[model samples]
Target: MQKKVNWGILGLGQIAHKFVADLKLIPNATLHAVASTSGERAQNFAAQYDAVHYYGSYEEMMKCPDIDVVYIASRHPRHHENTLLCLKHKIPVLCEKPFAMNGVEVEEMIAASKSNQTFLMEALWTRFLPTTKKVLELIDDDVIGEITGVKADFGFKAKFDESGRLYNQNEGGGALLDIGIYPIFLALLLLGKPEEIKAIASIGKTNVDETCHMLFKYSNNRIANLHASILNETATEAFIYGTKGVIRINSRFHESTSVTLLLNDKEPKDIFFEFLGFGYRYEAEAVMEYLSKDVIEHPLMPHSFSVDLMELLDRVRKEAGIFYPTYDRV
Candidate 1:
């Protein structure tokens, strides 16, 4: 029998809860430990998830000898620090996206990973979903023909709170990093890096982008119109247009379970996928499989991909004039 992969989660936030719930769906994976700045929260989370260990501080959790990998679910601003800590201990890591504050931080994390010879990957769950796989398969099979353009948006009205993570610049709060990355990821995944990027944003009272709009142009006239907002609820859908047809990822495209194919002069067909938990299991499974093979990086979500993604995000921020002084300073 194969040994169970022991998982350690570094942050006990809302996303960690959801990820732990999905982690339970993997047969060979076990919640070995959980850590949080608050001892009470860490204890509560460990108890709730039946984890073997819990630590009040992230540094304390790293002392554990049995953690096969640590999932860094901390806020965007702390991703670089958390990932570097894990790499220093030579522990494998699955850090949540945007990966880090910018391209520089991402490159630093990758350097640590390489120097330590530790496994590292960005936890971009959408990349491993069935819907995403199906979309890529269809495009490769010419179901969507030659891709011409892509349009995607993700937005929700967030409650205004000056000190909240969503509104605090020090916490890396902004629509672009919070929810905007979904649309940007879709564009990057489908169309590669843009040749030119034009962006604009509405900076709210808290001095963060409440709403951001981006237009990307690629070679051969391929373009992508992407938008993200915390001011109002938008359709939250993605469309990939091609010469022969178009493919529409259902609402909430980032975690969407279905996609509709619309061929020219043909009937629209809907495709659905069923999965256990909140669809995070796929990415977890991918990580475990790579670990079993002693691989350092995920083939699908490679280090170069994260670097390019962060660089593209930095470009967009430059064009939109969105800056996080705390982490952006050289």
Candidate 2:
């Protein structure tokens, strides 16, 4: 018989609900507990998800002996402390992306995980998607030949809510840290770090970037054009161009399940991915699998990848002259 991996959710938010719905999709994965600031919300979520336990405070959930791992779904500013608290309690952590505002905080989180000998992984769901893996394989097989350029964008015309998370600098809100990371992740995953990064942003009234456009130049002469914005709407598509042909990832590429390949004078080939519950199941499955094997970090989306990605974000923010006021608060 296999031992079940019981999961404890530290914040009951939008993402937490999706993760809980997917928990039942994994074998031997149980929604053991959920925590929220409101006791009513925590109890309701527990009942809705069939969790065996629920707590009004994160500290209370951390002390639950039934939970094998803790998933931190708190806001960007709270990830570091939430993770550290879990680590000290000997619980592994799977933290949501924009990992912790910046790389310095990420380093400290990594250190805590190491010191406690508990597992910790940045919960970047894109890297674990079936579509993402297929896209990578196609590139590796030179399906499009020598890569020359890449273009991707993620944006939406978000309503003006200065106090809300998206536009509020005090809450670590900005286009670059929120949506720009998706495009940057694609570039780095496909082309590695670039020699030159040219970026500019439109700083909105709240002082956070409303839009950001980035250009990366590699030593191999390859270039990537990436854009992100919360002030305007975009197609949210990603395209890869090469010497032989091109490959296009359909709308909302970051969370998309379809990819199309085009070869010279040939009809386009489309590949589709089918997965469980909001497509977050794949990453959750990866975490459970690692825990069952007594492993610390996921090989596919390792700590180094998280660190490097944050380093890139840090550099991009610097170039764009965008800084969040939440850094000091975190």
Candidate 3:
């Protein structure tokens, strides 16, 4: 018999909406409850999604007997605490990306998960997307022989709203955590942890990086260039350049729909995949599969990998002189 996992959503934001929509597309998942700081807001979100239960506080939802897992789609600042709360209830958690403010916080969450013996994963949905899977297959097969270099960029001209999360120093806001993570993740996937990391950024008046460029040098003589910006828009595409061929991912590479491979003398080949609506289902499915197998973390997006990624981000911030309020306690 198949077991269905009931979910309790900790925050009802745009990403949470997408997660709920994707959950409806999966067979073994159910939207059991939702919690928000306000009862009216929780009720409204519940009514829109037809969720069975709603709570004004996360503590109430975590204590609910129906919820088998808790999905933390709250702001990046709250991921660590929300994850700990779920672990306290012995419920598994799938936390949103930029897992926490820094590596120290991530270590704490990981330690808590270990102590509770619960399943926990970063919601880096790109790793589980079908298109990204195919790209990995090509890389593993040496279709793009000995990746010489990789280039990726994610940027958009987000208006400067002082009150917005992107510009606020208190919310762990900045181009780095808000949009830079995608390009950084792409580079890390192609070339593990870089031997040398150097970065330059345009610091805004608020002290947060508004535009950033990063260079990664790998031990195997591979190089990667990545960029992200909030002051202007870029292609948001990615290219994996190797000796024999190159793989070009479409715009919004993080949630890519297809990729093109260019060979030495042959024409480009386009490969595409149909994704479940909004694409969060893949990661959600990964959580279910890992839990059913009694695994504490996902192999594809392991906890150690997540920690390394956070450390890299921490280094970048240190170099760029961008500090958040959360860093003090982190």
- Model-by-model lDDT, in order? 0.94, 0.89, 0.89
Q: What lDDT tens digits, residue by residue, belong to model 3 across residues 162-192?
A: 9888898888888999888988888888788
lDDT of 3 at 106: 97
Residue pair clashes in candidate 2: none
Measured with C-alpha atoms, the lDDT of residue 297 in candidate 3 is 90
Per-residue error (Å), model 3, residue 189: 1.5
Question: lDDT of candidate 3 vs native?
Answer: 0.89
Of 1 and 2, the candidate ahead on lDDT is: 1
Ranking by lDDT: 1, 3, 2
Q: Write model 1 residue lDDT over 218-267, tens digit each, in one string.
A: 99999999999999999999999999999999998999989999999999
Best by lDDT: 1
TM-score for all models, in order of appearance: 0.99, 0.96, 0.97
Candidate 1 CA-lDDT value:
0.94
Total clashing pairs for each candidate: 0, 0, 0
Q: Which is the leading candidate under TM-score? A: 1
